[model samples]
Target: MDTGFNWVKPMLLMIALAAIPSVSLGAGLPDRIALDSLKNLYDSVQFNHAGHIRLLKDCAGCHHHTTGNLVEDANCVRCHQNSSETKVVACRGCHAAQPFSAEAQRKKQAEMKLYHQDKPGLKGAYHLNCMGCHQKMGGPTGCKDCHPMNKTGEALYNTGSFAPKKTGKAAKEH
Candidate 1:
């Protein structure tokens, strides 16, 4: 019962190759943060690093092979990028209906607003973690990098069937 076209090896190899270059090339930002430091901070939910990197002349500085907004290694982002659901963490879930604001917070079914007081705000955490590093590395940053006022667009993920790995799970692709 062997088709013999196993694809796991190639998939793992590509992941490894992509991970090798995600280090801090020079632009300066640490690649990790504690979970307690990540609650309610990402309102729009796209993890603004990619947008921030676009403004920099050197892409590698923030986009090293093993860090910042890509699936690589043991980075905090690698697994959590999808949040609890299979959504893009925010890209498809929230849909921006309007920009995230504290006003929306007070009306957010109570549980959501007070849910993560122990965690640092996204902006605050990013600042405390990388502000100093960027200063040392001569990097550019400002309020806009973290909280741009206007944002739009769909993430446009390819439609595909996917599932978690577990023993004895059986299904068919239509």
Candidate 2:
């Protein structure tokens, strides 16, 4: 009745449990994301995270590091992992602020350009990721669509703007 097989069941069960991916890991998804880490030259991009989640199939659509399943917080070590603590890297941490001197600014710009040749600056990264996805999904692809200008022609924030534009024949019919 007991031929050392008792341990095998428990061992197999443990393995199976370990193999099962965590359904609820990492930080909970936010309804909205105000990207104001960097100084707001333009309006802090008001990201509708909840809406995006509904429209997209997977969390990985926005969180590139994620792989369909919910990502464990421990695994987010690629960007800002310290031995003592884990932290999200701020844009300014890498992308230095605009220099005051013209020559210094030019040099800094060149350096940033080279450093982010593949990765790109904060604005560039946002444009490539957000705008690219919007374009692919047949959404708005205009400056005013994301960053609406004020009556005086300055970028405005939280003014009930930044809605996706309706277009095409079907949109016209409506």
Candidate 3:
């Protein structure tokens, strides 16, 4: 009767209890996330994931109904009133990088969900979600606020002498 498994039950119980608080307090969440899907013009955003979690104290604020939290937006509540948590909670999981691409457009058209017909692309989703909140909360709102533009972006936009010099037929076309 000298089995060594006597402590297993109590140890498991302690671990389970310890995990509950961490999950609720955002202890295991990533401290930062790189939002690089749309990094053509700007550098990948060093998203302060943990900071936002601490500030907002609610995953549903950004993850929406995917966090198993109640939907507050009238539009989202209409259909997702009883929406449960989903496995894929990341924005990129639902919003595509090239949402307007032919393949993406075809897939969107094929989907039966009429409610998500006009779902914005991943880039648009970030801008829409962050910009409005920032404006209201007195956070950074300029284009360079979150992700500063790279050298290529400056050149493309004709910022100073960084603009590529056009010659021959290219110049005439413009």
- Candidate whose TM-score is highest: 3
lDDT of 2 by residue, 1-174 (tens): 698688999999889867644432334445677865343434456877667766785765555443454444554544424333214333334443433458756766777745323445555556677889888889889876776454334334333344335545668899
> Each prediction's TM-score against the native?
0.24, 0.44, 0.74
Ranking of models by TM-score? 3, 2, 1
The alpha-carbon lDDT assigned to residue 170 of candidate 3 equals 95
* Better lDDT candidate (1, 3): 3
Summed backbone clashes in each candidate are: 9, 0, 0
**Leading candidate by lDDT:** 3
Model 3 alpha-carbon drift over 4 Å, by segment: 1-28, 160-174
What is candidate 2's TM-score against the reference? 0.44
Error of 2 at 157 (Å): 17
**Residue runs of model 2 more than 4 Å from their true location after superposition:** 1-27, 36-42, 66-117, 151-174
Winner on lDDT between 1 and 2 is 2
**Ten-residue region with minimum lDDT total, candidate 1:** 151-160
lDDT of each: 0.42, 0.57, 0.82
Against the true structure, candidate 3 reaches a TM-score of: 0.74
Tens digit of per-residue lDDT, candidate 1, span 24-95: 443334233232222233224244453354445443243332233443335645644553323233221322
| Cα shift from native, residue 153, model 3 (Å) | 0.9
